[model samples]
Target: MASTPGILTHWPWEPLGNFKYVLVAPFAVHSLYLFAVGAEDWNLTYLLTFPFMLWRMIHNQLWISYSRYRTAKGNNLIVDRSIDFEQVDRERNWDDQILLMGILFYAVHWGVDVVAKIPFWRADGLLLTFLIHIGPVEFLYYWFHRALHHHYLYSRYHSHHHSSIVTEPITSVIHPFGEHIVYFILFAIPMVITALITRTGSIVSVSIYVTYIDLMNNMGHCNFEVIPKWAFTVFPPLKYLMYTPSFHSLHHTQFRTNYSLFMPFYDYIYGTMDKSTDTLYETSLKKPEDVPEAVHLTHLTTPESVYQLRLGFAGLASKPLTSKWYLWLMWPVTLWSMISAWIYGRTFIIERNTFKKIKAQSWVVPRYRIHYRLQWQREAINKLIEEAILEAEEKGIKVMSLGLLNQGEHFNRNGEIYLERHPKLKMKVIDGSSLAVAVVLNSIPVGTSQVLFRGCLSKVAYSVVSALCHKGIQVTSIKKAEYEKLKKSLTTQDSSNLALSEKGYNQKVWLVGEDLTEIEQSKASKGTIMIPFSQFPPKKTRKDCFYLNTPSLVAPKSFGNLHACENWLPRRVISAWRVAGIVHALEGWNVHECGDRVFDVDKIWEASLQHGFRPSGLIPA
Candidate 1:
């Protein structure tokens, strides 16, 4: 919002909230209705309008993903600032401007007969659109933008946009309702005149022009220096006509300068261009990628998990990620990501964070769980993990923790293969089993005498069950084989409390893992709590039951600038596996906890607590 809210401060359809699109639905349907009933060839003009609007939306989304991917690399970043949840929430309404444009366009098409009669092609009108845009549209927008920077208008309107000092591509369109109305009028000038005076406008020309605007708008705010200096040198005057992301970035940093829209001609002529634009651009382009002291190596889960990445949508990434109905519409991009990952066949940095003096990064292996499950693909998956470890070691990373399926006991003996292969390596490899055990054991509510342990058992489960039985808490298992297998690992005193029976149905607490059956879950009473020892969470089977999150703890305030969640965990709450790597790096630990090696869960829990990572109670709701 602005410093002092003004008239028409909100969109007329603001009350509709997420349903604001309903306002444009009728016009969209009417456009389709005309096409469906076999209207005249020229009447198809209205039908094309809706698809053009949709294309604009897809164009903005691509710019968003591309900008995030580039900036996450840490090189060529224009600003050394962060984007928090507040900025994401503020900019989420970027599509509202597109919705407003749709309304105004449908109104014009309905009122003007000439718009309906416009032909499929008009060479003269396209030429006029170019001339008129450079003449009236660009020049007028320059002054209009300048006027908005005046204290009064700036406080009431433009301040909302400057809220994001470190801009994303969508920041170009995040303006108040009144500001968008004026911008719509300025952009409409070329088309309106092309229709009224020359009467030679076509849907193709209009689409081409709007697409040009979207391209320039998205490009200007990417917060990276993609436009190379060589381009300006190759064609000198192009610099005068076009602007780079770093050029516009200066305006946000040092306000009251570089007020031109897409072209910098007006800024130069009016002497409003920032002097440091070129220097900033050159330096940003030359900046190096950051080197982290610790790296958490993990793999992708379900295909929908792609959007849950910090590089994806901010709102979705900031919360505990779950499958959404609308994600089905993003299948094209999902399929592309899968194909690209398969072809690229290597790890890529997706997230970055700071822990005091230590820099940490989360690198993804690009392969999903199903890929690792295939007998033929295990070797390839191991190869990817091996490459990532070598790369981290070469970069002087002190610690690397294998997370999720990347550390499967069957595949690599919990990341033990890398250690055996590289005997004298300085970097320590850990599977974080100690922390996982600590989080799970501490998470069980106090005074709970018995817990029904279900699902596939693993090393972490064995450690947790032993500790539980020793604590005088009764441990019960429904599977007799699992019970006997666990009993063999425990001393007689501890094993005395471990029981095997079909008594699981009467228990209120359950410690679950992979392949937990639906029938087993269905037998549990309502309001039962399901705690998972595995990195992957169980599917929510009963609405009444409580499903705790995977092992994770809340990050400290010192670990600032976190704008996204870790897998299914909420914002700033990191997985224990990831925290273990950082703690190991920070404390200068030189031990490996994998294969037959053991960890003191009590010691790890104490060390992590001392580092300010508080144990987060795992209830999602």
Candidate 2:
């Protein structure tokens, strides 16, 4: 699903409008029943129970409708998240559900003739009903709910409820009829047991208890926080007693914790409370605008790696060993993913915002499995990237960085094609390698004597080495021919007192090459740093070694227990930082000549037939 909509201050009516009249339908029926039969006769109290069932349905529907409406407007009480509108559209059968519920509820109530009057003022029946309902119902439901999560039961029945990962109120009741039957028995058990044991027949007491349970159930699935942070702060002990919207949301999302019915006390007692529950709850309450914007970045991911992540996710959904048949069944899904990856693929926004309220939204450019196949489909992929850029621009994103390989090479080669196609779009597109080089330079410590610049043959690498050498820092390279060319350029240009060499001058090693297996093998200790141009991680890497990885289409494999790259940096974040760097780099350029970034300006002009126009000082040879 896309990101949740901007929070609306006013009450939302779209989702609520679906149930506005439905909620009152039961009340109309209740009114008719009361009008037909006067309160003078207590003998027919059994029939009046159907009206009680109707009232319960109405109240639950109201909570569901209101919660959904609020969440859709982004006025969610807790988490800033949303489900696909498609899920809501597909599950728009609540009218049918309510009719079925009404029939089932009437049958259950009619079959049981246990008559009980209102016990609003009566202490004995009210207290007894509360005790019985809370104790036995909670105990029984907890085990029953946990059992429903078992693989066998879950595949057959419970997965229906789990279908709504981001749930609404009706989602609580969207279960199999068999599970519903089990719940009905559980519900009736407490009331019937309480009535017989106390020798009391107060229908009002049972109604109140049922209403309270229904309210909590709907609230749990509401997907909006109804409890304020201050309540938990002031009380301090209320979290143990009450289940917040976030508390129940974890059950739907993480699928393990917060399994109690009305109270979380049972979850706590059973040691099943999610470890991050409190923190996640409070974090979800923060305003979306308060988070920092993330600059999303991405490169090509191997199909094998992508498939592995898919399999891991599938395993999480089903048991692994016995579910090999399930895996075989998923070949069609995997094939479809391959086909989709060749077309639209998955483009997503990071669900959570940063601390500074910056959300990093991402766009994935589609490609094939192998490199040659990707090359053959380059034009198609470029079209997808262009489409992604246009879409991001429409969504108010000012700039988006291209990935390093396919799209990156395309932009570096035929940037004019993009400019010619989308002439009116204001969104800036850049390859981002220039900014990445600048960031690496700034990160290197001040007093380093000699630095190895691997992969110096490429224009980006050559540009970086030139800049560093011009700054009077010694730079070395492995590629002899490129190193000799750079040495000639520095000597002829009369750059600042430079210590440029062909090889063997390494005091600190900076591995800038796409292939790092050679450097990884040669480096002994202290000075090895990895600035990968591809998605591969450093081999036998140390924890202290510096590694800079741009967010890519495929995540890099983690080395041992350490993460070698800045894996969390988003593509938009890279764009934001790159824009900032361009503003800094523009200082040496002719101010009156252009306002756009050098590479961005290059797209509009065809200065050189072979290498294209190079902005002066920004990409000096």
Candidate 3:
């Protein structure tokens, strides 16, 4: 069985059009019945009930209409409201019609029972008949419902109801009328038989049963998880034995297990209940082609196999102890403990290695290793910068300013130092206190266009460019590497005679990069503008610097002087684990064990990849 469409796809609001008509038809019939019987007293109550029913109908209709209007206008009441209504309508089945008819029929039954006053005749023993009626009726309904799913019956009639996998409220009433009538007859037979046998009938019991059935049936088909957990908990055990969203949801998906709608005991006793709820009602019968070979490998190596092997040896060793059944049971217990210990140790080793690498870097401890790529973050920042630059450029501005200053102990009086005293790429030094760099760049704005800074300096740059944008000053990135690259790319014809002169360093183009403590000073001095970048939490601290000198236990026998190598072995192992498929399987198993029912295998894979696991040679091709 496959998973059904999401709940919202079959929301009740869609098929509300038929509700009013169904509801009115019942009341219309009731009104005629009351008039023919000359029941003037029941007339007022019937009139009141009509409006009550009408109110419910109108409420459903108005909600549906408003939702439709909102959807048509491309305004979603909730997130992810991108629905193809036409496609849904095209695929709609008759289940909804059956649901509506069922409700109407139940309502009419209740009305007839109320008008007949059957309870008045059996006032002394009414409760006994009610209980007897309920038991047999529930039993018959459960069996008949189960029978509908038999291979022969399902292909003929039942499949039509399940065709609309995601049931809409109106579609809840749209089942084939013939199926509905058959079901009604089957359901009513038990009650009628029990009533005859008991010799105690009650109109009140009939009315209550009919109303309860309609409400619950409607709820089951409503395609919404609106019922509270407490409601399910507090309801009688037999209530869950009948149809609920969870039960019905399973039925819709598998159409085999969970056949008993009014009682789960029947299904449980009949061995139809699926013990493993990992996939709920989803079909467990995997196609031969869909069964991955990896699953077979996993099963072969699972802890259960190891435990069985250990248990077999323990059982032989405990021959005398086996005479005492309780002592023999300890053999399996000891084996289970050994298996559990191995699993725990393996998990601990993996977690320890993962934490070690994360602790080695100043970078954030990413939720997943794939995030290290920083694709989305980089794209977003680039887009913002591009838009800002383009807007400024459109206004005839050529020069942009950036406000930045070197901080941290590695920096000298001149803002230049390798971040960690690296042997290559000596950092360029700049005067931290003086505004000379800003002034020089500001003067040659037209020729040396573009300024770039890390997000940490965005705010300061924003201040410097604010006045320039108004007066048409364009600014973009001016990093040395970028500048050199652009210079090489510029053609002689396109190149202007631009000189980086110190006089061009004017206050107008100088944008402060750090947080502005002196906002009043910045505004008062109209020449120099300052903007503050949004502050982010500091990066994680690296306790010790990693180099190639790290030794590896798995080094080749021919290798010499392993300690001389600069590569970090632990970091590589951590990275490998992050990308491993086994790690994801473990995570999935853990989530399921923890009782989080929903599982997304792809999400697990993506998270594993983001965390730093590269496949390398370890992953099977």
The candidate that wins on TM-score is: 1
Candidate with the larger TM-score of 1 and 2: 1
Instruction: Please provide TM-scores, in order, for all candidate models, with all chains considered together.
Output: 0.92, 0.44, 0.33
Error of 1 at 210 (Å): 1.4
Estimate, for each residue in 45-86, the C-alpha lDDT of model 3 and write its tens digit. 344344444444434433333333222222111111122222
Q: Candidates ranked by TM-score, best first?
A: 1, 2, 3
User: Deviation in angstroms for 486 in model 3?
Assistant: 41
lDDT of 3 at 386: 32
Q: RMSD of each candidate?
A: 2.6, 19.2, 25.1
Give the TM-score comparing model 1 with the true structure, all chains together. Answer: 0.92
**For each candidate, what is the lDDT?**
0.86, 0.51, 0.34
lDDT of 1 by residue, 99-143 (tens): 887887888888888887888888998999989998899899999
Q: Give Cα distance to truth, residue 238, candidate 2, Å.
A: 29
Q: So what's the TM-score on candidate 2?
A: 0.44
| Selected candidate, larger lDDT, 1 vs 3 | 1
